[model samples]
Target: MNFELDEELINYKEKVRAFALKEFTEEVARTHDIEEKYPNELRMKALHEGIIDFMNPWKTMIGIEEMCRVDPGLGISATVPYFGAEVLMLHGSDYLRENYLAKVISGEKMMGLGVTEPGGGSDVAGLKTVATKNGNEYVVNGSKMFITNGTIADFFVTLVRTSKPDDPAKRHRGLSVMVVERAFEGFSSNKLTGKLGVRATNTGELIFTNMKVPEKNLIGDEGKGFYYIMEFFNISRIFVAAQSIGIAQGVLDRTTDFLKKLEASGEYVGEERKFKLAEIATRVEASRLLMYKAASFLFNYKPNPTITSMAKGYASETASFAAETAMEITGQTGISTDLERFFRDSKIMEIWEGTSEVEKIVISRMILKGEKNE
Candidate 1:
């Protein structure tokens, strides 16, 4: 089987890498990380440079990888302006697409996704946010915690409980997705600072107390929000896998460079360090292949959740592993250099989108159900 990117994709990947290396400088990344700020200027610049291509999922995946390789925080910040556009593209009404998605695509606005609640971590079906239908509007009263781009987004594709499920055991029912604007009355967000990593990407808590949403904002069927969100996750998990692979690859690159510098300076690098480096390289390559396999299935519209979960779960773990191993190899030098930032940044890969535990659950459940690989 051919395992190479097409000529066009290869060129685009190089272009993205060049753009990232030029823009995502050490000083810029350090400032954003230290200040816990989002780089809106970089976002706009990438947009203007045509680096943010959503039409081609391959380009999106490659761009994410190359950019994050340079600097995870700035890389994510530059590309996260359209965080929840998939929901709109797949399920939203024409009006929603024309008015909202169009603006986001044109760089006129930014968006976010609101799913996790105050007490909800990986329990997506257990969200407490509720939206009550009133006339032609829905009055929403609930809060979302750890929402990406929460404060800066012009709107959010939010999930809320529309009705109580008749069956207590099946609590995933009666949920709905809708677009909630930041300008709406009673809709407020508190920017959260001091994140463990990816500090350049905005995070906040969304509070909606009697926030009114137009009925037209509803995406797809009223009770199909859960399925829609799940589908979105299947797509997003691939990108997270890409992000994880990038971080792992980045750590490997830095560690290899450090070892080379030591050897060039007449210092003998130990076999243990060489073995660790080799293992990191192997894991990075494996993670990339898994991510590509998952992406192939997903981009073709025939998603295999087992493979996708496997890719994301394994890649995230690899990223953390590579960073930690690099630290062990470089010791004090690694701690003092920018590799320290990568060490901090690699951790969120295991926690966001779907946790490693959650991915394990998905893979095991799918396997037990005898889901065939397509």
Candidate 2:
């Protein structure tokens, strides 16, 4: 398989690297993590540089991956909103796209995805948020938990149940996707602080208490929201894998640099550290290959459920493992303020988007499906 990126894509990657180096200094990265503040300015810079509007999902994934290599929190703050806009572009009506996509791409408006509820995590059909139809609007009720950018988003792409519960088989049938602005009546958000990682990216709970959303705000067709959401998940999971891979790469790079310095000063190669570093590097390379395979599937628009799961599972786990190794190698200095933040941040990569257990389930399902087909 040809692994070389095209010239245009290579140029785009270079652009992203230049922007990150110029705009995302070590001090800025530290302040973001320490203060748990959103990187609003950096996000705007990314928008202006066209990193947010870069059309190809594969390219966008790579760009985000590279950005996360610098700082995962900054990368999330910079790219996650575009994921929402991408949903609108792919499934919303022309009016919705016209109104929302440009603003999102321009960074004038921030958007968040709302799917997980207080009780629902992996079970999309189990979401409890309700939306009752009115003449020209829908009245929404219920809250979304653990929403990224929830506290600061200008608009939210939300999934709500419109059908009754009596029909268990039809639960996924009557779900609808709609857009709700933060300014809507009865809509509110509160920030969730003290997170273990990615603290610079805002995470919060969004409450919709009889909030009214315009009829035109509906995404795609009515009752097909579940399918659309699933499709979105297929694409988005790959992005998360890329982000995790980038984080792992970053940890690996730092560790390698640290190891080299230690070796230069005759500290790391003392027969004890050799095997540990070798093992960690091997695992990191495996994770990178899995992530690249996932991206290849996405780039070709091929169905690769197994590869996607493998990518996310391996990359996230590798990120954590690499961070742990880095800490071990660096000893007290790694746990100190200089490197401890990255280690803490790396842990969350395994938990968010989808947990490692959930990824294993997905991979197993795909394997079973393939076996049955054969």
Candidate 3:
């Protein structure tokens, strides 16, 4: 058995890489990163050019890797418009599928998932956002924090508590997922600026002050929203792993170029530098293998939490490691370059989707519970 990408995937990867190189220029990346601006024009161009296809998960995964490899902020901005459509696809009703999915898929509208709330870092069950059902509508209140595509998205797949739990220990039992439209009365968002990395992507806090969301917008069963969101995370963590792999790889590429120039100038290129490259390269390979392994289980209709967490956790830390190593290897040059941006961007990979700590908890618990795959 071999571990080569099929001709189809290879060709597609090259196509995306070429598009990124041609269109996502250094000037554009630097400008966006420095100005803390969302790359809407680039996003529109990528959509029109069909550089990102959300319908196919594998393509989406590969496209993210290739685009991010060039510039993390711009790449992430361009590819993040359909951030939460998976929830609608997986658990939404026929009406949602026909109405919302088509618009998002056509790139006519943007979307995001709202799971993290103010004061709720990764504790989804501990969310304070509540949606009170009234007749045929749900009046949503409370706020969501650190929502990607927040200010720009036409709607959001938001999680909220639908009722008080019978048991104090079962807060998750009352949690539910529903779609909240931007045009809804009492719905507002505050743009969050000055991010450490991924400055080109939109980030904001969503406030729902007595906003009335249609009851029909609820995804799946009422109490099962938590499970659905968890399942989505199990799937999404793979993509996060992919994103981390991309950052690591981009750092590796730039660092390699720096080293080559040093060697060309007859600067004393030591074995230590060579070994560092080897280590970064090896970790990148291992992260890719882990991501693919996790994706194989997920995309094939079998979700493996242990493997997925392992991939997401290890890959994110690997990204940080690669970026820091690149900084160390390039020294002063790294500071004067975009590798600094990549270094900053590498950090969030360990924080979002699931923190490195969260992922470790997931991995350890799964293995100890005897749910690990052989």
TM-score top scorer: 1
Leading candidate by lDDT: 1
All predictions: root-mean-square deviation over Cα? 0.7, 2.0, 0.9
Runs in model 3 lying further than 4 Å from the true structure: none
TM-score to native of every candidate shown: 0.99, 0.94, 0.98
lDDT score, candidate 1: 0.94
- State in Å the error of residue 330, model 1: 0.9
Q: Model 3 residue 126 lDDT?
A: 95
Window of ten residues with lowest summed lDDT in model 3: 365-374
State residue 15's C-alpha deviation in candidate 3, in Å.
0.4
Ranking by TM-score: 1, 3, 2
Clashes of each: 0, 0, 0
Global lDDT of model 2: 0.81
Model 3 lDDT, residue 339, Cα:
94
- Clashing residue pairs in candidate 3 are none
